[model samples]
Target chain A: MRSAADAAEPAPPVRSRPGGRTARIRTQVLDAVTAELAEHGYDGLSMDAVAARAGVHRATVYRRWQEVGGLLADLFDAAGNQRWDPRDTGSLHGDLAALNHEIQDSFTEQPSLAMALIAASFRSEEAARALRRLWDERYTQSEIIVERAIQRGELPSDVDARALLIAATAPLYHHLVLLRTPPDPHLPELAATTATLAAGAGAFTR
Target chain B: MRSAADAAEPAPPVRSRPGGRTARIRTQVLDAVTAELAEHGYDGLSMDAVAARAGVHRATVYRRWQEVGGLLADLFDAAGNQRWDPRDTGSLHGDLAALNHEIQDSFTEQPSLAMALIAASFRSEEAARALRRLWDERYTQSEIIVERAIQRGELPSDVDARALLIAATAPLYHHLVLLRTPPDPHLPELAATTATLAAGAGAFTR
Candidate 1:
């Protein structure tokens, strides 16, 4: 496998612990894997290829990742780190719109990255499992924002925080995969509108 | 290329009137293409395979689709046929929730089919293009429902219809791809909440 670290753009380390030899090597390998995923897409990303890209022995890479699927799961989670914090914007619409815009920019800006991961997930159970890890981690962070909205009475107490969060991000993906268009610049506006529609349903106060 | 059509799935016969023999063969080829896509996805699909599957000469398949991408565009349009009449329900929340639930159900009930199409979309530019065609068609249809809500004074007229639709659907895709989990049953409630929140936004009512 080639050292893929240089081939693909660097993704944020998902759960790396700093200052350890083994951890550092694993990080190196993961970086390589991510680079390859970005460059080659899933069909072309093989364990052998990743090892070569990382300048690590194929056996060493295999020892860590086990299979192509496992490696993908690890790298995907590592790359898709959700680092945003939702501060109180004091308005539900603004908060949702801001979050929506940030997320939309991340996905749509490098759509191929999202597309590759999505494609890989469909083909490999491992990729799908890995993607879930990222989704949940990010969801947890978003849940905090929704909870705050409830606490402030900006939203209904009964609204399912998780549901609203999902609704908030759904449109950008829909625009890309289904609509086959670049997400609109008005994504923040869209998020606010969705938040309003959901609120009208009494999801917020409930 | 293999005939993926379920023998039981009847092909709508082409009317004799219209484009004559050329049209008939084109329709047959497209029908065959749709069945193949449903079965094998885009990566496994090729013109040679299509020609073989359709039992038509390679020349005929080539003469029509010309490129695999073009063929997918045709099939994508064919596959996306979602029709739901708007019901005022007086309560926009309940109405939208029901719609969100239905869309989520469609994807969840057919994981393999959804996966195949989504995967195919990533591999082939044609498939992606075609997928977009279908998505836009559906989006347009769904927008009518939201538009009606605004007219009824149940929603703010300024709310972005496209955004609301995306928020309603994004979670389903996220669950399918990242979570690798079945869609949540609570999607309608989530959709309702999001809608309500958006409609309540200060920017919405004005």
Candidate 2:
């Protein structure tokens, strides 16, 4: 029988790469953690378990992440930085629709990332800090789009850009995490509708 | 030293009282758990810590919630079920504004509930399930307002009621959770702006 300590030791490298073996191993372990999180959740997550899953030593995980919360923060940063550059769709509606499509795909395609980050936020201060970091990044990124709309006169000069952005995607998370439903196809439309409303509301103008 | 086995024992009677001393203990423990969550966040929360805080036996906390996940679920349920009977403001905007105010207060005042649940979700399947249950209750409650508007003919008959309801509250959560911002004081004005947009978009009619 394996003692908890045995599961926690560091292991030899998994993939031999020409450059940055350390980075590669880190990626592999984080990937393993993400998979385990999708399957087992946070309580089930352990350095020992992650080590076994990643084929890395428990010591390796501990060395890299320092703690489970630290490991998750790195994973969340990687996930949040997953990209979708905005296209010049010429119309606010078109750009918003495109943006919403990208988000919908992100949510539908890689649910584990969302689930894991959300789960971590509840249990770890480190995870909360990491999550808040991602949240800020997201807000900043989305604001750029809304600001462009304002400049283009597709939106009011006084539009509540932050409010518009929140109205757009908040429901999807709400549905996935809270309501336990796959977000509806019409969600993007509703989001666009809300953004357009906020843009024209001129709340920011006052 | 307290072994895990010892912690697993069924709780003894906490005290003889009306409303079942066990139930009172349960409530006390739950309140302690909630307070701990609010003060320290999920990572800082521990069953032993919660027991110590509540002045109850560690066995009592474990027996009631079963695990950190169970404790979170019960807390999630309690907070989510904090009900508000909607007042008839005789207009869609008025009703929505009022609802948004209540929601803003709920999350802003008790941010720990959100933080704990998110952290727990990372670690426990049961916590995720509990979160979803609480959310379902909120979604259903919010929908009632939309239905009321429809019944009153303040909006067209053919609106996507579900979408409308989601639109109304999703932004509130988005600001709280994602943006980490306290909602604007003029939330009613914001809601009114949305109602105006909905009316013009013929979101319900079309």
Candidate 3:
């Protein structure tokens, strides 16, 4: 089903020349991991199953990944190292809405990689830590959206970056992930506008 | 080793004879399910283990509940039937903050039942539906908080109750569950206050 993660990584890593055997094998194996997670979740994820799907030797998969948890940690590590620049849409509202839309898109994808990986974290501590790092990086990277807003005079100087960012994005996660509700088209704009108004009012003041 | 749900159910059920053997047996078995889930998560949940823990005959466990998924469904049903009123602390801010605190408490308890059961939903359809119903009930009940605020002139009459409620509580879940960060003591009031201001600004107008 290749469910694990066509969407997990933003784009395909270069296919042939530069990276060599180690990199190619890792890609194949990790891609298999994502597919396995999508189809079966962590409970059904196994090294043998991943090896069979990846067409790699079981001994090789075992040597590299060691276990199912290793496969998850590496999948997240691969994702963590990907490049994801928050799109600059010129206005704070536009920028935050873009960010929320991106989140909604990832979460809504068939066999959603975001959903599978997050679900994996509950059963695997290694995967959980890796998920934490990935989110930390994404959140840190997104803060520049808020930084630009401040420079653009869209927000007050005392706005707490973490608090503001979380406020702006938390509703999407709350609605999509926690409530498991069908995607709401109004959510991206509604949440962004709420965060923008609240930020303007100094609700997220440090 | 009951990781499933000491916190899942809010309190100890009546220990003695008000409910007869059938009811008592159900409670005992469900308690065992919660404990097993708490210790091992869904991956470790088993009918045998539940039977052993509950001190009920194995045939009895199999006869009624049927399987692991059945146990989760009943636990949630039991929780769904419980009486839970959103506290009226005389103001929207106080009421929402108090609501957030209760969520935080349920999610922070040792082997947090809320976390365990929510995690289980990712694996079981029955549990997922039950969770959806439970959340629906809670959200519907909590609309009174907004209703009260509108009555008290604290917010506009057009507030989208669901949207405001999600904004008010999403951060705690985002922090404790998704981001896996330590709890911030200020979170309850902070989130409640933000939702309050945003509602006043008409950000959640339906």
Q: Candidate 3 chain B: worst 10 consecutive residues by lDDT?
A: B1-10
CAPRI docking class of candidate 1: acceptable
> Ten residues in a row with the worst lDDT in model 2 chain B?
B1-10
When 2 and 3 are scored with TM-score, the better candidate is 3
Candidate achieving higher DockQ, 1 or 3: 3
Q: Residue by residue across A98-190, what tens digits does model 1's lDDT show?
A: 776665655554525665666677778777777676666666776777777778777767776766666666665566544557667876675
lDDT of 3 at A9: 59
Computed on C-alphas against the true complex, the DockQ of each candidate is 0.48, 0.34, 0.81
Error of 3 at A27 (Å): 1.9
**Quality of model 2 by C-alpha lDDT:** 0.62
TM-score of chain B, candidate 2?
A: 0.77
Please give, for residues A46-139, the per-residue lDDT of candidate 2 as tens digits: 8888888888878878887898898777766654555424656777766676667655555555434455456556567787777777776666
The iRMS of model 3 comes to 0.8
Judged by lDDT, which candidate is best? 3
| lDDT of model 2, residue B107 | 61
- Cα DockQ of the candidate 2 complex: 0.34
